[model samples]
Target: MNLQKFSLEQLASFVQGKAVGQTEMQLDGLASLTQADAHKLAFVNADKYLDQANQSKAGALIVTEELRAHITSQQNFIVVENPYLAFAILTHVFEKKHTAQGIEATAQIHASAIISDTAYIGHYAVIGEHCVVGDETVIQSHCHIDDGVEIGKQCFIDSHVVLTGHCKLGNRVRIHANTVIGGEGFGFAPYKGKWHRIAQLGSVLIGNDVRIGSNCSIDRGALDDTIIEDGVILDNLVQIAHNVKVGANTAMAAKCGVAGSTTIGKNCIFAGAVGVVGHINIADNVTVTGMSMVTKSISEAGSYSSGTPMLESLHWKRAAVRFKQLADAPLTQMLKRLDHMQAQIESLESTFKLRK
Candidate 1:
C-alpha cells in the first residue's frame, strides 16, 4: 500500500505537537534513527540516542523540547511532550495500511456455519459446524474454529489459533497466533490407586477489545465459566487457569501465570513472570512487579512485590545463612532485654520506698 507522505506541519498537527523546523518537509513513515532514510521520520527519547539523532539521515524527527539544543541537523523537527508516545501514535497510523482485506476461497467453512461476507477468512482455515463469525472479522491461515463457537464483529484472529467448542468471543477481540482458547482445565481426582479425569464442561467467555498474545493458553472452567472481561491485554506465554475472572482493562505481561479460581480486579498490571496463587482476589489498580510470587489475596490497591533479585553465588549463600538465623536471633535478644529492664525497675522501686 503506497500512501502520500505527510508534511511536517501535518504530522505536528496529527500528533498535537509544536513544529520546530520546516513544516513543509515530507515524511512517508517512521523508522529507527540508525536505519531511517530521507523519506522517513525518527524520534529520540533517550539522552544516549541524541548522538544517533544528530547523525540520522531522516528528513524529520520527533523529540522533546529539552533535546532541541542537541540537534545538529537542519532537518524538520516536531517537538512533543513525550516523543515515545507520539511515535506510538504515528506507528499505529501507518500499520493500518498494511492489513489484508476480504476472505479467501480456500478456507474450509462448514455449510452450517454462519460467517459475514465482509469477514476475511484466510487460506486453510477451518470453521466448524454451527459456528457464527460476525462482520468485519479476520481469521487468518490454519485457524481452527470448533463447533458452536461464536466470535463477534471486528475481531482479528491470527494464524494457527484454536477456538475450542462452545467458546464465545466478544466484539473487536484480537488474539495472536498459536493461542489456544477453551482448552480443558487440569482437574483430576484420585480414586482407588487410579486417577479419574474430571470433565471440563464449561466454556471460556472473552469480552470486547481483549488482546491475547501469541502462545497463551486459557483453560475452560471445570464446572463454571472462565471469564476474561472487556479491554484486557495479555502478553505472550501467559497461562490463565480455569474459573478465573480477569477484570476489565487489566494488562498482564509475558510469562505471568494466574492459578485456578483467582479473581483479578480492573486496571491491574502484572509485570513479567509474576505468579499468582489459586483462589485469591486481587484488588483494583494493583501493580505487581516483575518475578513477584503472590501467595495470598490483596485487598488494597497498591504496588506489591516479592522475590529477591539474582546475586553472586558466594554473597547469596551468606545472605541465605543470615536469613535462616534471623527468627531465633530477634526472640533471644528481646527476652534478655526484657529481663534486665524488669530487674532495674524493681530495684528502683525498692530504693524509692526505703527513702520515703
Candidate 2:
C-alpha cells in the first residue's frame, strides 16, 4: 500500500501540537523510532526513548516540549503536551487503510433484509431475513447474522462472529472475530434423573460505541432481556452469563466471568481474571482488582480485592500452629487469673471483719 503523505503543519494542528522545526515536511506514515524511514513520522513519549528518537531517520518527530533538546538530526518536530496521545491519534489515521469497502458476490444476503448500499458484505457472509444493516457497516467473511438481528450504522463485525436471532446492536459497535452474541444461557432443571433445559426467551441488546473482544460469549437471558449499555468494552475470553446487566461505560478485562443475574453498575471496571458470583449487585463506579473472587454484593463505589499470597513453607507451618492454639490459650489464661484475684479479695475481707 502506498503511504499517504501529510504535511507537518497539518499534522500538528490535527493533533493539537506545537511545531518547532520545518512545518512543510511531508510524513508518509507513522512508525516506531527504530523502524521509521525518512518519509515516516515517529514519536518519543518518555525520557528513556530519547536516545532512539535522536537517531531516528523519520522526516518528523512528535515529542513533548521537554524532549526538544534530544532532537540532534535537525529533523522536523511536532512538540506537544502529550506525545503518547498524539502518536495514538496519528496511528489511527494510518490504520484506516485496512477497512473493507465493497460487497462480495459470494455473500448470501436475505431479500427481506434492509442493507445499505454503502455497506460491505464479505465472501460467504449470511444476513438473515428481517435483519437491518445500516450504512457503512462491514460484515466480514464467514460471519453469521441470524434472523431479526439489527445492526446500526458504521458497525464492524469481524470474521466468524455469530449474531444469534433477535440480537440488536447500536451504531459504531465493533465485535471481534469468533465472538458469540445471544447464545443460550446455562439454565437447566434436574427432574426425574434427567436435566431439562429452560428456554432462553430473551435476546441481547447492545448499545452504541461498544467493543467486544475475541472469543467472548454473552448469553441471552432466560426470561428478560440481557442488556449491555452504551460505551461498554469487554476484553477477550470473558463470559457474561444470562440475565446480567452491564451498565454504561463499564470496562471489563480479559478472562472475567460474571455469573447469571448479576447487576453490574455503570462505569464499573473489573480487572483480568476477576470472578463475580451469581445474583449479586455491584454499585456504580466499583473497581475490582485482578484475580479477586467476589462472593457477595458490593454496595460501595471503590476498589475491592481478595486472595492470599503464597508464603514460605516453614513460616506458614509455624503461623498455622499459632492460629490453631489462639482460642484455647486466651481461655486458660483468663481462668487462672480470675482464681488468684478471688483468693486475694477473700483474705483481705476476712482480716478486716475480724479486726472490726
Candidate 3:
C-alpha cells in the first residue's frame, strides 16, 4: 500500500487533464469519497455521487466537465473529458510491480519449447513440447501450457489456468486464474438413439490487449478456430462456446454466455448475465442490457433489452394468464366489430344533430 505520491498538477499532466484549485496538493493514494481522508484522491463521475463528493475530506478529486459546475467544495480537483476513464488509467500507474523474475528450477520445461530469457516461469508450471512463450510473459505457478501453444510478449497467464489444444495468444493478453482456454467443446452426434462425442479439432485465437477474468471457460471450435479479437474484455465466469467469433473491442460482463457459431460484431457491449443464441450475427456497436436473452440476430446497432420487468407475484401471474390467452382470442375480429358499432353511433349522432 506504499504508493508513490503525486501532486495534483503532476497527476493532471500525466493523465492529460486540467487541474483546478490547489495544484500543489499532494495525493498518496485513491479512495472512494465516503472512505477518503485529506491525503487521498477521489473522483465523482456522475451526478448521483456529487453529494458525497461535496462532503468528502479528500485532498483532490477527479471530475468530468459536465460535473465540474456542481462541485462547491474547496478540495483540489481535475476536470477531464471522462473522469472514470482517467481514474482507470491512474490505477495502472499506481499498481505494484510484480517482484517475481526469471524461471524457477522446479518448473518442467520440455527441450523443444522455446522460452525467452526475459519470461518468468513460476514453480511447478509445466511448459509442453514445441511451445513458444515470448519475452516478459509471466506463466504463474501451476499453469499448464499444452503442446504447441504460442503466447506473445508481455502476456500474463495466472495460476491454475490450462491452455490446451494449441491455442494462440497475442501480445499483452491477460488471463486470470482458473480459466480454461481451448478446452473441448460441447459437440455431439446422435446415432441409433445414443449420443456420440464429436472431436473438437479446432483451436482458440486470442488477439492483443484482451483481458479475461477468473474462472472463465472458452471452448475450442468444432472445425474453424474460435476468434476473440483485439481489446476484447471478458468478465468472471463467462462462457464462450465453440466457433463463436467475438469481434474486436467488444466487452462482455460477468456470467454472460454466448452459444456456438455466434458472430458478435466489434465494439459491442454485453451487460451482466446476457445470453446470446447460436449462429446469430450481432451488428457492430450494439449494447445488450443485463439479464436479457437474445434469441435471434441483431442487424442494427442499438441498445436492446428483453425479459419482463419485475412485478408483484399476484400481478405477474394475472398478466401471464392473459398473455397466454391472447393466442386463442380473435383480437382482429373483435376490433372490426367495435369499429362497425362506432360508425353506426356516429351516423345516429349526425341525424340527431340535423333534427335539432
TM-score of each: 0.85, 0.83, 0.89
Question: For model 3, what is the error of residue 310's alpha carbon versus the real structure, in angstroms, after optimal superposition?
Answer: 1.3
Clashing pairs in 3: none
TM-score, structure 2 vs. true: 0.83
Scored by TM-score, the top model is 3
lDDT of each: 0.92, 0.91, 0.93
After superposing candidate 1 on the true structure, give the runs of residues whose Cα lies further than 4 Å from its correct spot: 1-4, 46-52, 65-75, 96-102, 326-356
Give the lDDT of residue 120 in candidate 3.
95
lDDT of 2 by residue, 1-356 (tens): 67677889989988988876788888778889999988888889889988888788888888877788866775588989998899988887777644557779998988999989888899999989999999899999999999999999999999999999498999999999999999999999999999999999998999999999999999999998889999999999999999999999999999999999999999999999999999999999999999999999999999998875567998888877886786687877998899999999999999999999
Q: Relative to the unseen true structure, what is the C-alpha lDDT of residue 245 in candidate 2, on a scale of 0 to 100?
A: 97
Clashing pairs in 1: none
> Model 3, stretches more than 4 Å misplaced?
64-70, 329-356
In the order shown, what is each candidate's alpha-carbon RMSD? Answer: 3.8, 5.8, 4.8
- Candidate 3: lDDT of 207? 99
* Local accuracy of candidate 1 as per-residue lDDT tens digits, 1-356: 67767888888888999886778877788999999998888999989999899899988889988887788774579899999999998887667532566668788989999999888899999999999999989999999999999999999999999999499999999999999999989888999999899899999999999999999999999989999999999999999999999999999999999999999999999999999999999999999999999999999999999998789999999999887887687877998999999999999999999999
